[model samples]
Target: MTSHTVQIKLNGSPLSLETSKVAKQADGAVVVRFGGTMVLSTVVAARGPMEGRDFLPLTVEYREKAYAGGKIPGGFFKREGRPDEKETLTCRLIDRPIRPLFPKGFRNEIQVINLVISADNENDPDVLAMVGTSAALSLSGIPFEGPLGAVRVCMVDGKLVVNPTYAQQSTATLEIVMAATEDAVLMVEAGGKEIGEEQMLEALAFGHEQCKQLVRIQKELMTQAAKPRWAFDAKEGLDSGLLEKVRQIATPRVVEALAIHQKQARAEAIAAAFEATWAHLVTVDHVADDAATRVKTQEYFEKVEKTEVRRLIVDKGIRVDGRSVKEVRPIWSEIGYLPRAHGSALFTRGETQALVATTLGTKNDEQKIESFEGDIYRTFMLHYNFPPFSTGEVKRFGTAGRREIGHGALAHRAISAVLPSKEAFPYTIRVVSEILESNGSSSMATVCGASMSLMDAGVPLAAPVAGIAMGLVKEGDKVGILTDIMGTEDHYGDMDFKVAGTEKGITALQMDIKIGGVSVDIMRQALAQAREARIHVLGKMAEAIKAPKATLSEFAPRFVTIKIRPEKIREIIGPGGKVIRGIQEKTGAKIDVEDDGKVTVFSSSAEKAQQTIDIIQDICREAELDRIYLGKVKSIKEFGAFVEIMQGTEGLLHISQIAETRIRAVSDVLTEGDEVLVKVIEIDGNGKIRLSRKQALRDQPALSDKEKLKIVPASAAGA
Candidate 1:
């Protein structure tokens, strides 16, 4: 086997691409390496399109092997099962940018697989997979739009770093993955700490410049490794004559249907028009086979729908919902929707609705992520669920799909920017968004609802976040930018730009351009329009709950944290967790002890939490020289009475110290189960405590040494 390697200096680091040594049977394959991390990417495409496939049947999979990080698989099966969340998310990171680069009319089944073969824990594999996938596709004979570059840019301490290390990303204020060609940026996924628009724009520009350099390297590799292009039939055939016939019969009704403001009614009207036109064509025009006519009619009607929607928006400045360009739909929200949840809200915008619920838990509740990098815990999580009924359809429901994961991650990024630091909040948070009805950007609605639900749950968020989905339509010279686009506009438009942020600045932004490329000027306008919509939505959310409640709900668990010496952690935990377990069992509270000696107690009752704290304090308490205690008499002895000061702590109350008299016996003044005040006079070297009731009883010093000598004990005088 012959090996070809391409090496270049990328952002102060060596980037290497090698191929022709492995996976030779695949259409295209390459291995990319940076630092010690490596990823193998391969692209495979079917020879011909599926029988009825109308869209690009492309799938991207990113998998991380346990051995990549030199670790054994952890589960019972001892092998990887389904893709974890990180793998799923990385798939999206690669798919979004590359999917748009495919030719529009090519529909052959294509699959791109990326595997992290090695991980050094410092460098990340996701970006490597992206660049490798692009190179593989470019080298393949498939008719792909050549050479796109992907880069991860981060701002650390006011300095921009391209492809930063994982450690640096943890401290960076802005992290974004941008994909672009030499001329324009095709995709972006970003999350920032309330970074301003201009700063974010600058970061994008920096990333794009880096992408240009990588693109150059890929182009050079393609020159040496490129294969002959394969020819395939167009996925969709436009029959002009038949299309015109359907348009003539359906244009009037399509126009009427587009004018209706109600989504369902308009959908019904459009369906009826399509049915009527199909019936006329089959019966009156003598259209042939049953299956052939069905396919032809559906295809023709969709084209007609696309043309009408785009023309109406770009030329007539009309939307199917009767809103003008840059106009947002009506929005309403309510908090405290579910009393049982820690926090809950229902946010509705036009026909889109989300019922979001937030739950707060202790450290034990954090999601454990065992990945190639290492085991890590996530404190904040947002999950989005899209039931088929939300779209007025009936279908089998199973695990979350790519769309659901992508949307949830987007919402998670948006809301996470405003979440309090782990040190400040000290609780694990989970937000679940259930889409009850969806016509347009339900993901954006989830963002708004998540923010409201968090605030309602008494989470002290930095600020409220809102999201808006924008769309674009361009015909010749006429161009229109839309705000708060619905499902119809999104499906027919050329751009789906989602902007999420606070009133001050953007936190998360994702854009995917379906067309070749969009100018920066168009993006600027879209961002400005989306900002307006976001502000309007935030204002509506503010009316529901301006701030987080001052206190957690009565039903929510109460948390109390305490700090002790690190060395004492084992003491509280005891030899076999006996001490801590006993405390939990006795106080009815859950306790989590950390290595740093930080103990957090969680309980439904505040009193129980406090009681657990008291128990812990007693367990860790030390005897002071001059402190007083209200101890109980555990037993009566000849020399003194054994008094229990605190749990497991006992002191000797000598007969002479029991009172200011010569007591005949120790039981004369004290009995078992009797409570008495005493002072800790001394603690021996062996940790034995000596208590003095006589010293505690004396409020004033004896008159003087002589006066004390003159004084007589009551028992002695009586004898």
Candidate 2:
């Protein structure tokens, strides 16, 4: 049996990592404890690399097992299966900080398994998991660049706090997870209410200070109980000798073709050049042997090349796309391009086209999200769907790949900068971007098309934001930044730095460098260039549709709101919410109320909303009235009846009023159901009823058929 103990101080709590006391037989195991949460991390290396694995094949999975905190599975699958979005996103977080820490040419089939055995819900287990991974790799003889540490810093009550509890994390205005080398900031992901750039920088500094102790522990683990790291020869990047030879041969002609910058023209020219040399010592002729051929085949093409490609273009005023460096691709677009959709746009830039559609929904249609802080409602969602036909191919149908999610998430962040606040539109919106064509920068095309659809649907966005993917080719000390990278460049270039923003400033940025990180000077240059391209994209977008339309379509629901005292909420809802049910039935509306006295009433028509509002008002109203009684006919011995009058209320009248003229049989003059106006004569002290028709009639005039004698008799009987 082997024993290991690693200790550190985390956010003022004494934390420790111990193995053997827990899961003893794992290939490499470490128990991570921060606050009261415990995450057991284990690293298991496969006997050999999976042969056909296209990628590094390192899997980092963090599971939130139900029994971690004594809860049973709640869904139909019974137990957790595939990773949820949260789990996937967390794995990315862990992988990013550790992936770069590995040494060059060091590839071992590795899988990191993280299990949460206890959750105190105080210190987040995610960051602790990252630290444990570093320790596990440090002691397991895995060639990892890690021994890196991470921390989550939040702004609470105007003060920066380290790794706050779940309760405190919500109230926090800012949440930033910072991972770093001992020297510089390596990775950062954050969500905040428009925090300033400078403040975010400061938060990173605060996090780094907190992460120092964990780094120290990683060094200790590496020094005390570490396996010998594996060794492999580091290939000195792309074949430099072959690259130089090809540069000399192809540089001037390639530069000339690229300077023209027509999508098809540049592509044809490059193909023509490569075709002429197809039979030389180029890629066509290769040696045998499965292993060596794969390596030599890629290497052979470089040696046949000659002259400088980028140097001739950048320095000698030539270009690969046959155009000036600052120029954009030819662009065209249209909206309402599809009539069946609520809102739609077909955007084209060069050969790329994205047919984007937008669907606006009500609050109830919002996406439900479950996170460590429990569940939440998301009012805005953007999804990117790519089918085989988009690229003219066929593949297996499955869930969205990492590329789809990453692109969709990028677009979502870009458009989110301009979306109306929840207090404004109050309707949930979901936008789907379909890539119908491909040339380059499809994600940026989605951004442009999504903006048009949003405007068409009458959403009052702050502005129409756009995105552009910029590429870079770095040779020696020189780097050439290309605007609106094409499909080929994105696959072969050294950098892909996508930027999204309004005309004034940046909204979101995602940069991945192929040859380590970029210098600040290059980043500034790239940012400036991306901004210019974005302005062009935005201008083109405006040609389709401008600002958000003033009103939603007729098919959209009408919103009615009512604010009442918070204490009276229960009164309106009633026991088991019986009153609410009655309101819903009477007016045909869907009503949802928050605890803070805010009520939302949704209906298909304005009339229904008005009717519901009226009924609800009546139920919540108080009123008072005066007097009560009933009156009878004066000579009703043989006559019918009459009644009294009150505000909007009525009673009957009797036929006894003709009494004074004659007295016997009483049937001579009056009948029942006749109208004789009456009033409340008096109120009994005990609140009993009282009535009098004769007194009321005496105060008014009494007209009879014979006394007035307005009719002249014709033949006596017929008349």
Candidate 3:
């Protein structure tokens, strides 16, 4: 194979795809470069399908090397470990769009690997990797019904920007990643700041046009270096008569099982129907009862079930749970369910329920992430956990998997839009959602529970947020969009569209189509319907908690922020951190000082917090002219005496200013370790302080008893 390259100008940058230069042995390989960032994508398929496989065995891996960003790994091994959260998310971003493009019944094991070879730290490589995956699959001739294109669109200053750089995305109010073919959109994942549905539609349309341009470029590359088509024939392994018999035996019973509203009951009924169907075939028809025959029978039974479920929705307008197409399920919620937690909520919609808790910490609790671009610290975090018992299953517990990460990321994005700024809140927040029961849309449940929990914890959110999952059943021209879809609807439906936001507009959205694609009009309708459902959910949530609590929980820590001169930071920290440590130890408080002299103290008791604040203020206090202080004489000299005024501050008492009359020596009026009242008579430009005892004696008679009592001795001031 010889090297072939194609280039185009996109969004004011040179975008290029080159092939046959690296990994030639793989079925297909492409290196995609945009600006200074580059991603190498390769696809390889097994020669034969895995035995007994019933689904597509596809795996997508994305890795970022430290050298790509001109840095080395941080750990002791000095090498990359497992994929971090960002890499795992990017892998899911690349896999979701292309996975549906493969033909049905094609069970070949395919692996797609994307490596970030160069990172300029401006343009993100995830979108580029998505495009490269589609191009590589198209060029591989792996029966992929594609040549799709992907683009990132961001709305900045009321205008949409295509393929915006990382800096542009950071400031944009709305950011959307869309993938599409020439005619229709295939996938969409987006997060916004309460953007309206119409605005989102316009952005999606704008991004699709850019996708078409990339599709053309991929087609040109295929013309130059595409491989010959691989020979794969999908066979119906079951005998025609046996399949017909199984369908007849299972269709009625499956429909009866689907009528059951409860998830557990429906599952048991379905299982019984499957067993009865297989048993009847073996006894009444004298059919063979081998393992292979049982597998075929089960496959046929599932097909019948899927067909009947879709028929009930599309033809009869009757869902499995007997709800209208646009009706949302029942909702109930409670706040402050846990007395000890900072905030807690139990949100249940239909059969799905989530128990969410919110915890608040100081700046030290923020999560630090190392990425190709740079290190990032996040003050707000949301974690979603799905236990096996939630769905009535028994399984081993391990670390979070890809599904949990993806779901948590979606919910995190949804609730992030309404959170208060770090400066306003001054506390690190973590929200954890535990799924107690699951029938459908547990991720959306997490979103609702988190929002309520935050409000119950007294975290002032801009607005309440809620999420709903919408499903679609399309049979040719007949289309049914179901609101608040359950697990059964999601499994057999053609689309799973999750929308989350406040009453104003949408904050996060994710859509995946199982079929080839859907038109823009269908998407517009879905969004409109989702908005209606989202508003209804929000109304129910408001009934539980109208607004954030007036006061934080007693168990939560109290925070106080104060600003001081930048130079005074060293004074607060002291040499070897002894000063700050002393303050914390004395008052049972935690203090964090920023470089710009912003000090935040956290404590459980208000009196202790105030004590800590008073200590910091005294250490950072400056001498003021015309103000009098009680001073301690530290030393004596022939020319002048240095008197200690504020903590860590001293002033020079000139021999002449020491008394009303001229003194022969400084020790005549003041001795070492003597406490005397002095007034700040002058402050020089170089910060030299001059104190006079004669002026203090004249002002002492005019001072009120309350003002005199407010003054403390210099030694006691530091204490």
Against the true structure, whose TM-score is highest?
Answer: 3
For model 3, the run of ten residues with the poorest summed lDDT: 704-713
lDDT of 2 by residue, 1-719 (tens): 66767786655787887765665555567888887788888887765545533346687988876676666766787786777666666677677667666654444578898887887756678887877777787777666666667788888999998878887787877777766656555555555554554565567678777777677877876676677875544463445554555455455555555555556666677666554433233544332435443344333333232233445445754444555666778888888886766677888887788888887677779888754445679989998877767666687667787667767877887788678877767778889999887766888888888888888878888888777888877778767788987776666566777777777665656655555445556766877788789889889888888788787666666778887677657767878989888888988887777799877787878999888777666555422122323222333443443332322123333333333444455344333323333434544564333334454444445433233221112233133
Residue 106 lDDT, candidate 3, scale 0-100: 87
Off by over 4 Å in 3: 236-238, 625-644, 650-719
Q: How do the residues 1-719 of candidate 1 rate in per-residue lDDT, one tens digit apiece?
A: 67788888766789998888899899999999998899999999999866676679999999998888888887799987899888998998898888877776687899999999899898889989999999999888898886888889999999999999888988999999988999988899999988888888889989989999889988888878878888755544757778788888888878888889999899999999899888888888877648766787787888888899998888889888888997888888899999899999999999999999999888889999886556799999899999999989999798899899999999999998889887678888999999999999999999999999999999999999999999989887788999999999999898889999999999999998887778788888888888888889889889999888888877778899999888768768887888888888998888988888888899989999999999888867887887877777888889998988886578998999887879999866666777776789999998999999777656324522333332233343345
Lowest lDDT 10-residue stretch of candidate 2: 708-717
On lDDT, who's better, 1 or 3? 3
TM-score of each model, in listed order: 0.90, 0.74, 0.91
Sequence-dependent TM-score of model 1: 0.90
Per-residue lDDT value at 394 in model 1: 92
Runs of candidate 2 exceeding 4 Å displacement = 1-27, 52-54, 97-108, 153-175, 183-185, 190-216, 235-286, 289-320, 323-335, 338-352, 438-440, 519-525, 565-588, 623-719
RMSD list, candidates in order: 5.4, 9.0, 3.7
| Residue-level error in angstroms, candidate 3, position 415 | 1.4
lDDT of 3 by residue, 1-719 (tens): 56988888878999999999998888889999999999999999998877777789999999998888999998899999999999999999899889888876787899999999999998989999999999999899798988899999999888899888888988999999889999888899999999899999999999999999999999999999999988766564547798899888899899899999889999999999999999999999989989878887887788899999999999988888889899998999999899899999999999999999999998889999997668899999998899999999998677888888999999999999999988889999999999999999999999999999999999999999999999999999999999999999999999999999999989999999889888888989999999999999999999999889989999898999999999999878878999888888999999989998889999988888998999888878999899988888888889888988876678999998876777788866666777778899888998889998778877876653444342344455456
lDDT of 1 at 202: 89
Off by over 4 Å in 1: 233-238, 626-645, 648-719
